[model samples]
Structures are given as C-alpha cells and as structure tokens.
Target: MKLIFLGPPGAGKGTIASRISKDLNIPHISTGDLFRKAIKNQTELGKKVQQIIESGDLVPDALTVALVKERLNNPDVENGYILDGFPRTIKQADSLESFSKIDNVINFVISDEQVIQRLSGRRMCKNCGEGYHIENMKPQKEGICDKCGEELIIRPDDTPEAIKNRLAVYYESTAPLIDYYKEKGLLLDIDGAQEVGKVAEATSKAISK
Candidate 1:
C-alpha cells in the first residue's frame, strides 16, 4: 500500500515508516536519505544541497520537489512506497496530488519536550554509522557502539536548536498536509509517544482502513 508519514523531527516517523514498509513489502523513500546520497556522490544537486545543509537552512521547495520527483519515478517505487518526507509545503503537496493517490497519511503526534529528549540523546558510531537512541535504543555499553567499538557521537545536525528549528518548520510547513489529507479522507493521526511496536501496530491498523 502506498503511504506518506508526516511528523516533526524526532517524532519517530522514520522508525514507523521503516516498520510499515518492511512488514507490508513497500519501499520506504526518504528525502534525507536521497540528499545524503547526493552529497556523497558530489553531484550538481548534491553540491547545492550540501551548501544549504551546512548553512542550517531549509532546502528550498524547487530543489526538494525535483529531488522527490526523481525518487518517485524510480522503478522500485512503481508498485508502492512509503514516503517519509517531501511534500513539506502546500505547493509540493498540491503538486503531488496531481499524479499521486495517497492511500494514507500517517501523522505521528509527539510533544516538543519528548522530541528534544529523543534527539538530544541520539548518537551514532563514526566507524560504522550505526545509530543509537540514548534511551530508547541504547548501545550495549555506555558511550560505545554495539556493532563497532568506536564511541558514538552526535552529528552536528542533532543539536537541540537544530532539532527545535526542524520541529518549527514541520509545524509551519508540513502540518498543513494534515488538513490537506484529511480533506481527502486519507489522514490518520497516530500517537508517537507510545512504544515503537505499538506505534507500528496502530499505523498498520489505521492504514488498513
């Protein structure tokens, strides 16, 4: 089933999206992953995105839309895909509606304080890049990676201010998609503060409708 997950940063949208995509056999496409690949390849779009990313500003809609369109047109997405990001603005959402039929819009609702705690505690292994949520998904040993012995460090983007800014942008830019999807009878708000497995179950139940 095609799906779009909407939520602020640290709201567990990615976690839920991954679960839904895996359990339902749908591709999980995320804009952040696309941009990271672009930056790694140092493509023209990557250079542009890297600049904006380093400046700690939102990637403009035009670039984001182009990137998203490229991803949506991929062969793997032909059957169905879980969109974890993109359509962060009215224009983009309107644009997507032109060609896409959103089966469901899963909105994960979480408080800002919880988001901060979730994000601030996040750390990743520099060697293996394995992610660990300090509290929710802790490493086997304190300040150490489970897979690699390297110490886990938080990326610069995971700062409290950046996380808060991302939430602000989500509320201002992406939250409206809630109404847009609701009008289409495709919006489902899921409580993100719950356990991951519970969240996944609730999401599946909602989308089954």
Candidate 2:
C-alpha cells in the first residue's frame, strides 16, 4: 500500500521504512537516497540537481516533484511504494496528492531531548562508514571502530545546535501534515522511544488495519 513515514532526525524512520518496504515487497522511495543515486549516476536530473546544490541553494521543489513522479512511474512501483523523506512541506504534499492519495501516514514521536542524545552521540567509522553511538549502541572500544582500527568521528550534522535547527525546520513544515492527514483518518502516531522491532510491529499493525 502507499504509505508515508514521517519523523524527526534520529527517529529511525529510514530504518523502519527500509524494513517495511522489504516485508511488503514495495519499493522504498526515499528522496535522500533518490538524490544520491541520481547524482552518482550523472543523469540529466542529477546534473541539474548537482548544479543547484553546488551553488549552495536548495533544490527547487518542482525538480524534486518531477524526479519523484519519474520514479513512481517505474514498473517496480506497480504495487505501491513506501515514501520516506518526501513531502517535506505542505506544498509537496499537495503535489503528491495530485498524483495519488496516501493510504497511511506513520509518524514516529520522540522528544527533542531524546533526539539530541540519539544524534549527537552518533559516531561514524573512519574506514567503512559503520556508525556507533556513545550510548544505546557502543563500540568494543571507546572512540575506536570495532571492525576497523580507524577512529570514529562525529558527523557535522550531529551537533546539538544543528539538530535543534533541523527539528525547528521540521516542525515548521512537517508538523502540519500530521493534522492534515489526521483529518482524513490516515495518521498513525507511534512512540519512537521503543525498540526498532517494536516500532515496526506497531507500524505493520497500522498498515494492515
């Protein structure tokens, strides 16, 4: 079924979306992944996107919408697709509605404080890009990668101020979608504080019902 997964940074929406997409045999259509793939492939759209990004400007909504439409038309999407990181604004939601209505919108809820801890403590491996956290999930050695001897580094985006800014921007544009979909009775809010499996179970129940 067509679904939208919405949540703040470090909420594990991407992880849950990937798992759900596999279990339901649907394409996991994430805009972030889409952009990365397109850029890596050097497609026409990618060239345009790369130019915009190089200029330090946000990719225009129209281009993003067009790219999504192209992906949706793929043969693999015949059954449905799970949307992650799309519809960042009400305008994008409107554009999506013009194409197709969403069956369910799953929102993972967590506090701001929790979000900071989850993101800020994240450490990335210097060698293989494996990630670990100071808490919840730690490495075999402090400040060192288990698989590789390279020291782990905190990603720039993991800073508290950056995360707070991201949360503010998300709430400003995305918080409204919760109400918009709730009015249509298609919204499912789940506690993101739970384990990933538990969250996935709740999401599956919502999608099934």
RMSD, one per candidate, in order: 2.4, 1.0
Residue-level lDDT of model 1, residues 8-117, one tens digit each, is: 88888888888888888878989889899889999888899999999999798888877777778888887789988877888988778776777778889989998899
- Measured against the true structure, the TM-scores of the candidates, in listed sequence, are 0.86, 0.97
lDDT against the true structure, per candidate, is 0.86, 0.89
Worst lDDT window (10 residues) for model 2?
155-164
lDDT of 2 by residue, 1-209 (tens): 99998888888999899899999999999898888888999999999998988999988888888889889989998889999988888888889999987889999998888888899999999789998989878999999999988999988888888888899988998889889888989889999989889999988987897
For candidate 1, the C-alpha RMSD (Å) to the true structure equals: 2.4
Best by TM-score: 2
Top-lDDT structure, candidate number: 2
- Model 1 is weakest, by summed lDDT over 10 consecutive residues, at 94-103
Evaluated at residue 100, the lDDT of candidate 2 is: 80
**Clashes by residue pair, model 2:** none
